[model samples]
Target: MKPSKNIVLIDSSRPIDRDHLLPLGRLRDLPEQIKRAHTVVVTKCPPEMDIADMFLWEQRLKMPAGIEVQFTTLKYADPLPVFPQEADKRYIYSKFAILLTSIANPRHLRYHLLSFYKISSDLEFRDHHNFSNRDAGKIKRWALKHNKALIITTEKDAQRLSALTQLPDEVKSRMFYLPVEAVLLRSR
Candidate 1:
């Protein structure tokens, strides 16, 4: 299907470090490139995000002076079994859990999980990482120490978890992921 509009999202949870979009004080793209966009959606904003911060991004991205800068957030959803066969059982939210993620930024995912479960530990990997049996061992060790621990991952990471067949059956049995998606915040 042809696209009607183009949208670029910037995570709002973290402050814009460098002058430009790219980090490390680098100039990756021309100001005009970012300004010509039809819409810019800032993602991963915390619940306390304010208008002052929204306007700060508008000025920083070099967007048009009066253009509206809409915001979006990482809205977390229901927890699902990592292994398909275990679908019938409801996730035990009360259990102490370990946060596992290979996304670019995992802070928000960790924050979201803490609201529902006790966070025992975290295993963060590079963005788009392919989990290995070695990595699974670390999670297993952590869960082993923490009684009734659930190893929870993000929805995107859940897709990758299916490919991680080498993980121990023990870990697979207790693992699950909470779905998360970008949701636009109330307009200014």
Candidate 2:
């Protein structure tokens, strides 16, 4: 049960950060793993990433001379209703937002939203955090205080939020999630 081709993926943001001092077993063996990969993908890159940075990533990751490296950035889609039947589309036009995220890296989404909304409050949780009743109550309280603000979450977080049946109708009506997709950056 082996694939014909092996691809290795790395987060473009990792090598530049010096804080993660712990040596992961896989990180220690990345060079050897890259040697076996047919392609190497650098993910979570900035959309404006240029060829020069891509080349630098190769050097930083110790990519072999001939291995192909491709860069990808997460592209966010327009806000979609978390609960379509209860959602009010006008909330999308709000000038303020209450950001709710439970993912590893939310900076990308926050950056994108900054262009459209003045974030009133940003609530972050560890990656894949389950929404508890207390959490929903906290969010509901925030949404109530910022009456005109939209409640925005990631598509991943929306799935967990949607499962909470106890969320108030007012909260459900203003909730939306941004869908994100990874797009390859091409050198022009």
TM-score of each: 0.78, 0.87
State how far residue 122 of model 1 sits from its true place (Å).
0.8
* Model 1 C-alpha lDDT per residue in residues 1-188, reported as the tens digit of each score: 96777665555654344346457533356546656557777777876777887777776777775445688777777788888774424445555888888987788877777787888887788999988877767777876887477878888888878777567676677788887777777554
lDDT of each residue in 130-153, candidate 2, tens digit only:
999888888888888999999999
lDDT of 2 at 141: 83
Candidate 1 scores a C-alpha RMSD against the true structure in Å of: 3.5
> Per-model C-alpha lDDT, please?
0.72, 0.84
Relative to the unseen true structure, what is the C-alpha lDDT of residue 155 in candidate 2, on a scale of 0 to 100? 95
- Candidate 2 wrongly placed segments (more than 4 Å): 1-3, 16-33
